[model samples]
Target chain A: MVKAKIYVQLKASVLDPQGKAVTTSLHAIGYERVADTRISKYIEIIFDETDLAAVDTQVHSICDKLLANPNTEHYHFELETME
Target chain B: MRVSVITFPGSNCDQDALEVFETRGHTVHSIWHKDTDLQNPDLVILPGGFSYGDYLRCGALARFSPIVKEVVAHAQRGGYLWGICNGFQILTETGLLPGTLLMNNTLQFICQHQYIRIETANTPYTHGLRVGTALDIPIAHKEGNYFIDEPGLRELQDQDRIVFRYCDADGNIAPGTNPNGALDDIAGICNTTRNILGMMPHPERAATDSVSSNDGKQIFRALEDYFTTRA
Candidate 1:
């Protein structure tokens, strides 16, 4: 089995209000050293196939089609083999 | 005019949209998201609410609904399509409309009456309205901030596709008047074809006097006029 781990985040150009709010909270709690915070989503999918090449293609396709929105987000994925 | 309102699971405003049209004496149909048929209506509306409980992002999951295929085809055929609030998010998800609705800058769900200025009267959706006409529409959403890339923003401006902008009662566009931190204070926009509109306001909620603001009726009237005059 192959497992795909994906990270999806708003494009750098887009504003992330939730991330900003977290940063504000951190600062309020005296974490002034933190420069910024950008929130992102992490997703994991397991495929029945063991082929890394095939899983890579499928993972990319899934991210483009549904897992992430290309308009405002950018996504990256890593593949790991599972016994 | 024949109108269809799509009802996705958790859609709360489907009936409101249908009631508004039915009261206007137009034929109205409620199309389920699972159905592939659109019933040959002249207009299709994706109503407001937390579809799929807004899971995986608002409107993201709902865009994959079977009926959206027909909705896309309908828009391609130049039929009128309007996405209100969550509906607007779905339109963006489906790529029928550009840009995305992000969470409000305040990080809170905002529900209140907002004044929006009509930016263009050239589209089928705003045919009879004059530019800069302010309508008292109600907006209710957690994610209503509209964002687009610089090039996309320029294209929308150059093509005159920005249909509505959140503004003051006096029709001034400013940050103070913007309920959400949308780029350019945009509240609504249309496609390059000018047939599809995605707006983050509930016109149906303000369509009757009982709602204390019938300003939204002007939009419905403009739609009816578009058909009646063309027919």
Candidate 2:
């Protein structure tokens, strides 16, 4: 079995209103020296595949189709085999 | 039937939308930002504009407006809605729609003509158009790029919710043909139910008789026809 971790976030140039709002609130609450902020989601899963290429393909298919919206968000995945 | 167009203090396209519906013989009402109780419009339109001065983020401030809350509720009940440009931003901000709008990869505002493919023309918002057809519409925005994660992107495609896409003048979805560089050259998409449409391109902007404006007339005509037929 192989485990995967996916980190997703809005592209660098994309506007993050929710993240900005939180930053504003933090600043108001006296969190100084904070220069930037962003928000993203993480997902983890286990796939029972021995072929590395097949596992990669399946993981990419899931992300490109559902886990992320490539138009606004970008995602990278990390995988490791179960011991 | 009555159509409601919500107007924020900073909204730029409210009048254009209002005129289009009025010409179609539908009663049009302009709702203010502070009114939480919507007059319950049969059709609601969130026009394109830099609402709330694009503060914090595009459509971010407007998403919290009293009018938006009611609009969100109306959509949940299977109400018909059309969001263009800034309205699209508001929809994402309010969580009424999936996927978020990000800044242009160029980090600059873009205003120009674009070719969008009709990915799914079966919805109330796109019924008049046929699948895989090409449309030439104008899109203007600083943040118009769409993004989603792996699982989420798949779910969107699997559900057949994609409605519009940027393509060549011939309606081809290719890499170099996109004006906004959207994923799959996506110009617009709908909720899983295919009732709520959020698109960055301004169909209303293309409805005018002035050069290059009437391209969006088909979209409005489709809606007008649907309402009349149901009535």
Candidate 3:
């Protein structure tokens, strides 16, 4: 079995309003050193198969095709083998 | 004219769309998202409201609904397709329209009457509108901020595919008039073929005289005008 951890975030060029709001609140609470803040989605998927190469390809496809918008978001994934 | 409004699980505006179309003296059908076949209506509308409960982004999950395949095929055959609000998000998610709707610049759920200047009257939805006319419509969404790559936006402008721009009451498109900070103040756009249109405003909400503004009635009338020409 394999488990995949995916992170999806809007590209840097895209403005993140939620992140900016969080940053503003942080500053109000006295986190003055915080220059900026960004938010993203973290998704986890588990597969029953043990084929590492095939799992890698499938995970990438899932991220590219569904989890991320190529126009505004980027994604990365890490996989771990299950004992 | 015949219109079909697709209703996804969470779609709240399908009935509104149907009412407006029917009131305009057209046969309207309510199609479920899971249906793979359409009844060959003259126009298909993906109405507003959070589809799939806004899961995985506004329209991401709804884009893969079974009926979208048929909708795409219908568009490929030059059928008129209109998407409003969340429906517009679905269009972008499905790649039927370019750009993406991100969280509002204020990071808030905004629901209010807004103005949009008609950029072009070339599409069926805007056929009866004069260029530069400002229409008051209701807009309600948290992710209505539109974003597109620079080159793609330039190309869309070059092709005159941009249909509407958020504007002031006098039809000015300055930054203050942009409610959601959408790139280029874009509120509505059409595909290259001009048959598919997606917009964030709710024309159906403003189509009735009982409503404060009936400015949106023209959009439905424009469709009828477009159909008359074809007939």
Candidate 4:
């Protein structure tokens, strides 16, 4: 079995309003020297497939087609084996 | 004209869309998201509301619903399709329309009447309205900020697909008048063929003067006139 963890975030050029709001609150609470802060989504998926190569391809396709919007967001994933 | 409104799991504006179509003297059909078969209609609309609770980003899950395939087919066959608010999000997710709606720059769910300047009256929804006419319409959403890459924006402009832009009362396009930080104050856009239109404003909410400005009703009137001319 393979488990996958995906991290999705808005592209560098896109403005992240939610992330900016969080940063503003952090500043209000006295966090200094913080130049920037961005937010991302963490998703986990477990696959029953034993073929590592095939599982990797499947996970990438899922991220490209569903987990992220290619227009404004970028995504990367890590896979590992579970006992 | 016959109108079909698709009701997703959380569509709150389906009834309003139906009523408006009926009031315009058109037959209306309500279709569910899970249903595969679609009734033939002069226009198909995807109404507003938090479809699938707007999980995993707005309009992400709802775009995969079975009925969307039929809607795509209908649009491809030269039928008219309009998506309002959440429906507009679904169109971008389904690739029926270009660009995407992002979180509002203020990070708040804004609900108010806004002024939108008509950019082009070439589509069935805007054929009767003159360019530069400002209409008072209601917009209610947290993710109505439109975004498209620079090249994409230029392409849309070149094709004249941008149908409406958020503007002030006098139709001046300026940063101060932009409710949401959209790339170009874009409020509504259509496909290159002008058949599919996706907009952030709630035209149905402003269809009656009893509650709010009826300037939005001009959209329906334009459609009726468009169909009459074609017939």
Clash count, candidate 3:
0
Name model 2 segments beyond 4 Å from true. A1-83
Model 3 regions more than 4 Å off: none
On DockQ, the candidate that comes out on top is 3
Compute the lDDT for candidate 4: 0.92
DockQ for candidate 3: 0.92
Query: Residue-wise lDDT of candidate 4 within B1-231, one digit each (tens)?
Result: 989999999999999999988887889999999999778888999999999999998999998899999999999999999999999999999999999999999998999889999999899999978999999999999999999999999999999999999999999997688888888899999998899999999989888657669998899899889989998
**Per-residue lDDT tens digits of candidate 1, residues A1-83?**
98899999999988888899999999999999988999999999999998899999988899889988888999998999998
Interface RMSD for candidates 1 onward, in order: 0.7, 8.6, 0.6, 0.6
List residue ranges in candidate 1 displaced over 4 A: none
Model 2 chain B weakest lDDT span, ten residues long: B177-186
Chain B TM-scores per candidate, in order, are: 0.98, 0.95, 0.98, 0.98
Off by over 4 Å in 4: none
- Report the lDDT tens digits of candidate 4 across residue range A1-83: 99999999999999998888888888999997677789999999999988889989998899888999999999998888888
CAPRI-style docking class of model 2 based on DockQ: incorrect
Compute the DockQ of candidate 4.
Answer: 0.90
The digit string of per-residue lDDT tens for model 2 on B2-82 reads: 889999979999999999889878889988889876677888999899998986567867876878878978988988888
